[model samples]
Target: MSNLSKLESQSIFLLREAYRTFRRIGMPWSMGKDSNVLLWLAQKAFCGRIPFPVLHIDTTYEFPEMLEFRAWAQKHYGLQLIVKINEEAIARGVGYETHDPVTVTHELKTVALQQALAEYQWDALITGIRRDEDPTRAKERYFSPRSSEGEWNYKDQPPEFWNQFALPPKGAGGHVRVQPLLDWTEYDVWLYIRREKIPIPPLYFARNGKRFRSIGCRPITHPVPSTASTVDEIIAELYSTRTPERAGRAQDHHERNAMQKLRAKGFL
Candidate 1:
């Protein structure tokens, strides 16, 4: 099999493993390329049916285009999309306009996610986090278990030798976070999208002489100056771009270990 085929097989295996092990499971859909790809892989793995609901933490600051595309994808794929909003934070004006990105992310994204998890008891959460995305994420395992408080202990991860993952103990309230595409890179994601003929949001293509290299909330996400208007062109651009994918994300720029700190505090 080709390398991409191998990656696809491993991802599917991880997805199946998570499904088999966890009773109540869910995946986060941020309306980004990674999550979109993950949703596609779910359909592929389950033969056109996604078993669990796709959770979307709406900070209310997302770009309008993102919400539009999200609705479109949900209908197209028959997805059970659960939108979790931080009403308290939004009511209190806790976003980039009034507060810092770190504070806003913690209040709007992290806190909202924790509350959602509490509302619905989940045995595992399947996320689309890739190891190549960042140095901190690079330390993640294919099936990393978190504490009851939803905290990740990077130093004490389970052993996964020969593709065998250690299952979390039964009746454990804290669900494990399963990463199916931990080995895939940014370029690989684009290549898979092209290969699968997946429909991506139009924001990825250049419009009006600008395009967003990485997508996030409107206020925190700034597009890089790019003229690539097609998927093939974007793939070529990735070959030459050396900057981090999250570089344009304002929260990542606010502090050196911002992502690490957030993940440590159960953000993701």
Candidate 2:
């Protein structure tokens, strides 16, 4: 079997297990390549029908194309997409223009997600986090348990030897974080997208001699000068590029522990 097929089978198995174990569950959709691929896998896992709501925590500063693509995908794929925005934060003028990217992300994305979970009574959350994305995420389990405050204690993560995931302790706020694509890498995601013929946002393609290596808000997201406009070209470029994927993400470059700090406080 192909590597993509193997990854798909593993993710399908994990999705089914999470569905059977959790009561109230949802998946985050950042309108990015990873989450979009996860959405596709969810439909495949459920036989062309996704069982859980797809959540998108809107910070109100996302690229306009991202929102448009998200809506189009929801309609085209028949997805039950729930858009959760930080209304209060926006009303209070919280954004990248004024505050630092890290703080803004905390208030508008992380804290916003926590509030949405509480409001929706979500017992579990499915994410597209990959171990290869960063050092901290590299330590996560397939099924990660968080405190009531949504803090991840990586030091006490459950063991998953031989695909046996230790169930989280009962009565833990009926909430857990599920990661099915934790083993997949950046290359795997692109290859899958290519093989599956999935349509991604046009911003990934070169425009005016620049292409966004990573998608984020306009103010904080910077694009590198690249001539690759096609998926195959992008894959080739990635093979030759020495920069990390998150190198252009302002928040991630803010500090040594910026991502870890944001994630520890419930950032996705």
Supply the TM-score for candidate 2. 0.96
TM-score of each: 0.96, 0.96
**Clashing pairs for predicted structure model 1, backbone only:** none
Local distance difference test, each candidate? 0.87, 0.87
Report the C-alpha lDDT of model 2 over 58-112, residue by residue, as the tens digit.
8888898998898899898888888888888888888877889899989989888
In TM-score terms, candidate 1 sits at: 0.96
**lDDT, candidate 1, 1-268, per-residue tens:** 9888899998999999888887899898888898988998999899999999999999988898998998898899999989999898888878788899988998898889888888888878999999888889998888787777778888878787887777756335677899999999999999999999888888889988778877888988988778899999999989997767877889887988898888887888
lDDT for model 1: 0.87
Off by over 4 Å in 2: none
The residue ranges of model 1 lying beyond 4 angstroms of the native Cα positions read 170-172
